[model samples]
Target chain A: MRDIYAPRIHGIDTSEIRKVFDLAAKIQNPLNLSIGQPDFPVPAAVKEAMIQALTDNKTGYTPTAGLVQLREAISTYLKPKIGFETEPDNVIVSTGVASILFLLFQTLVAKDDAVLLLDPYFLIYPALVKYHEAQQYTIPESFDEADVNSLNDRLKKDGKKLKLIIFASPSNPTGKILSETQLRLLSNLADEHDAVIASDEIYEAFDYEKRHVSMAKLSPHRTLTLNGFSKSHAMTGLRVGYLAAPPAYAGIVQKMVTLQQYTMVCSPHAMQWGAITALKTGIDAELSVMRKRRDLVYGILSKVTKLPYPDGAFYVYPDVPIDSADFVTRAIERRLLLVPGYIFSANRNSIRISYATREDILEEGAGIFCDMVRELG
Target chain B: MRDIYAPRIHGIDTSEIRKVFDLAAKIQNPLNLSIGQPDFPVPAAVKEAMIQALTDNKTGYTPTAGLVQLREAISTYLKPKIGFETEPDNVIVSTGVASILFLLFQTLVAKDDAVLLLDPYFLIYPALVKYHEAQQYTIPESFDEADVNSLNDRLKKDGKKLKLIIFASPSNPTGKILSETQLRLLSNLADEHDAVIASDEIYEAFDYEKRHVSMAKLSPHRTLTLNGFSKSHAMTGLRVGYLAAPPAYAGIVQKMVTLQQYTMVCSPHAMQWGAITALKTGIDAELSVMRKRRDLVYGILSKVTKLPYPDGAFYVYPDVPIDSADFVTRAIERRLLLVPGYIFSANRNSIRISYATREDILEEGAGIFCDMVRELG
Candidate 1:
């Protein structure tokens, strides 16, 4: 029989990082820094909440928009923390923020519509946009800051066909945050162009330079802010995330969520309860630990001859003296694994290293990476 | 501002059945039979597996296809039970069978393609097909045995445009199981028309009269078998279900799953561990309990003044002597709750009564139901 696989799906290869992690798993390596998950245990309180929910028989399906209490909690949390005054009606709890983005892309973009990506972006974003039969337009990030004028120029050039603009701040790989002025400029341009902005704030809690500013707070009219517990609370496996939107777009997203209702009902009910606890009790200690780890990795990486200082997330994007793919291959040969930056975009000389590891592992991995660079030099 | 809600979402008007349930909830009714969830704790071994996984911090994302061990267990379990020589590659663990159905629709059905559904069917099936922009061609069940020749004639007439056909056996609402001959005939028709057959056997263990046969076993070339622990082991809240298909189609489904990976990375890692335990240990005792409940309710429901005895799932579909909506409302007035058949399809004279409650509650609910039927008569 002819291959039944959809053409769009063929383009999404498994994550390069996951491939490395698989290798690490096979070798039974202790203290590997290959994958993006946090090293901390899920909070005792969060786990306790899940156990309690399970015992309470809270396993039946919740409303597709999610539990009213959780959405309300998210609304409350976002307003004070991110300056976005969202109502419960404007929030939909999803299986994860990943699902929210998938739904948003499905609802907003049709075949042939273009979604602009801030290049060196999340690996999944391009694959997701492509799955909708939508085109992806990547605008390389200006290392100094997000350049709003250039972005506006691109939006103006695209005319009416640009459906969405996706960016993460404290971005994955790059770890760059769009300043408030830059966000205002992009938001204003999006408004003028009549395009939606999907701001992925999954890494918002891990930012170091300044408090994260949500695009929704700056432009509530056109932004859908995506956040979740996976990153902030070390609950990646629990798979709970949500989308907060303006009331105008809420119905569209809700319709998409209703479709999701048939697929994965509400996020696992116990996980929803766990997420409620995570949001209600802040992740201060968790953030402090990640920050400390981030600082340690950044300090070591910055001392390397040609690497740039790290910014945010658990990653460092170092400019390798050789092709990134080759650099990564060489590093792995010496028992170190780092994601090549070319997988995120087209750059060939940069590698992305995740600091989501124990300090000792980070120290060992960084030493190996430094030795590799010196050998290559 | 202009309503920014996407054009696709149509808000659900509160149905008469929902109104009845709302009133029942307010009154705190004891013999409630409204929703479809089974009233049983998840098996002890399953719970133990989950607790052990949690304690061990087996809380990271599993492979997108689900944990290898769980898929292998499902493969081993289904091989003999369903008469299919399945391999691990043939199975993909999903958040629930609901998700498997959703992914199948998205992957196979394109805009305006017709998918054949059996009515009165599961309520979510049509909605999910609609979400995919596919046309739902529901052939109403005969209440007598399904006429394979008539179904074949319809498929012959539609031919190439019919992309898929879905049926549950023993079916939901009606609970009628297709005989082996009927399944073979349907499989022949699906093969002739090149249409995919999705066999939802989530309630396979609830079959009381005879062994259940999977359509995939009859036509492995053109069928996908869906099953899960929710109904069988009362793990509804745990939300793990799976689909097993021929290698060619399983690949397509897996790709579609990859696209929605952001929604759920895998079934909860811990849930997969629990499900493996559920499958390994077996659900024989649980099946016996459900069969006993089915026998009790079937007997009680058959004695009602004017109701039909239907065959599968935990539900007994009986014709209400009064307007089904009115009968349900009246039942709620006396503190009973049953799903009116209109929600499943356009069956206005029947209601679906679940036999998933405890025996004492089932006895009381059935007595009240029969009393109401006789009073209305």
Candidate 2:
């Protein structure tokens, strides 16, 4: 057959995270810290709502934008949490935050348009951008401080070429949460650059030190806020997320949703029901448990030299004494799994350790990881 | 803000189907026949399986490709249906055939790559191909006969520039099923021209006259068969579709799925469970009910002078006696709604009426449509 695969898509390598997952899947071990999914079951209220939806026969195609009630619930939920006032018309329920991000990339990034992505960002961003034939410009995060000057300089210089800026607050690999001031500056810069900021707040509920702030709250006109029930309510498998944007962009995004109609008609009806319940009844208790787990894992990991203070998203980015890849490989050999920082656009010397496990598993896994570090040293 | 949205994306027009949908939504008292969703509920077995999955807490991200058991089930099911012996690894459960089609377009159609689309095609095909920066080459269908010679000549003239060919068997909008001889000729032409064929068989189960034949069964190496439960089991809201391809191209498609991880992580676990049950237990009863509705609507539509024969996919594309747009507008004026064929492609003087509604609704809607056609004549 003729080589029909698109040139831009052929270059995406197999996910490095999946490689670790494959290794973990092979082992017969009981505990798994390798997966990005929350270990907790979906909240009972959410599950019950889904069950109720099924019993009600709410199993037909929803409007391509999504169920109005679910969208309204998301809009209402975001008001107090993110300090943004959004209407049902502004919210589009997606399969997950992943799908929203994909739409954001497709909607904002053109064949030659450049998208600015923070290094040590979620690994999927570059791949999605490249899939749209857009150029991905990685701006390394200055860990020295949550500095906005470097980013501003880059945005000011390459602003015209840049179409979108995507970053996860309480980011993957690095649990770096952008402060309110830093976010404001970034939002201002994005507005100045005429670039849309796609703030991924999927980890909003899992922040330990402080409440997460959404860039959308600061600049609603130029921001697409993406979050879901995946991490917050432990409904990753449910595939429910929402995209909130200014009404000006809703028409365009809804058109993209029309295309998505061919892909996913709408978020699963039962899942949308679950999300409605999740938004109506909050995830405070769930957040508390995740916070406690975050603290427990951080307490154990701090003993290791050069471990940055873990902030959020059930992960700690620690500087490994050895190469991060080697440390991860050896940890896997010891039957413990952690994502290498290299997967998140970082150097190979730092590893990401997820803290979403139970206390006992956290203790055992952290001990193994520390011991492995010492042995390698 | 200097329009952060991509110019290329903004340049593409909003879906014409959605415009018709908006008009339908605006009508105060319309006998709606415009939507493509199955009016039936998902099979009892499917719903029960989903309920069981919810109770069982089968709510976590499946393998990026999809659930192993589901893929295995799909493999087993496809062997006899497609005549292609495939392993589980060759199948990827998608959000729907729409997503798979988008993935295939993104993977194969780079900028300037020409994709041949059968005209009177699924409306989304051209938009999606255009979004990927590919040129769409329309091969107007020969309504009365399968004209392989002309098709081969056109394909041969384009040769390497022709990256892909997309056609729906038991076709959408038209509902005409491609005969086995036509399938063989097209597949052979694709192979000879070194082009990929994407056979959308989402409507296969609704075939009335003959058992459906998968293009993959005829041309295993060059064809990608797209199917899902949305139509077959009335699970449009559930969003589960599968792509069956040969092992060689599976890797490329898998990579695209990996990139799509953010948009939809995996099809909903609950829906996947439901789909497994739907596929295992045949949909003969559901098909019978749908056929009855189809027949009722067809019998009514047949009375309209210029309307064509109803074929497959719960839809009847009939040439309207008046301007197709005017016919639909007049119908709407009289509280009846049907999709104008101009939305499917330009200059087609027809309307697509979905016959998936209940007997009473179908009868009422079809009566209104026939009255409008008679008045126009």
Q: Name the runs in model 1 displaced over 4 angstroms.
A: A2-13, A19-31, A143-146, A280-286, A305-309, A374-377, B1-31, B140-146, B159-162, B248-250, B281-289, B304-309, B321-335, B359-377
lDDT of 2 at A93: 82
Cα lDDT over the full model 2: 0.77
Q: Model 1: clashing residue pairs?
A: A59-B237, A99-B262, A252-B6, A314-A355, B175-B311, B175-B312
TM-score of chain B of each: 0.91, 0.93
TM-score between candidate 1 and the true structure: 0.90
What is the C-alpha lDDT profile of model 2 across A241-346, one tens digit per residue? 8888777667657656755665556788878888888876666776688778777777776776566555778787877788878888778777888888877764
Which window of ten consecutive residues has the lowest lDDT sum in model 1 chain A? A2-11
Candidate DockQ values, in order, are 0.44, 0.65
Please give the lDDT score at residue A46 for candidate 2.
84
For candidate 1, the lDDT comes to 0.75
Best by lDDT: 2
* Candidate 1 residue A341 C-alpha distance from true site, Å: 1.3
User: Judged by DockQ, which candidate is best?
Assistant: 2
Model 2: DockQ score: 0.65
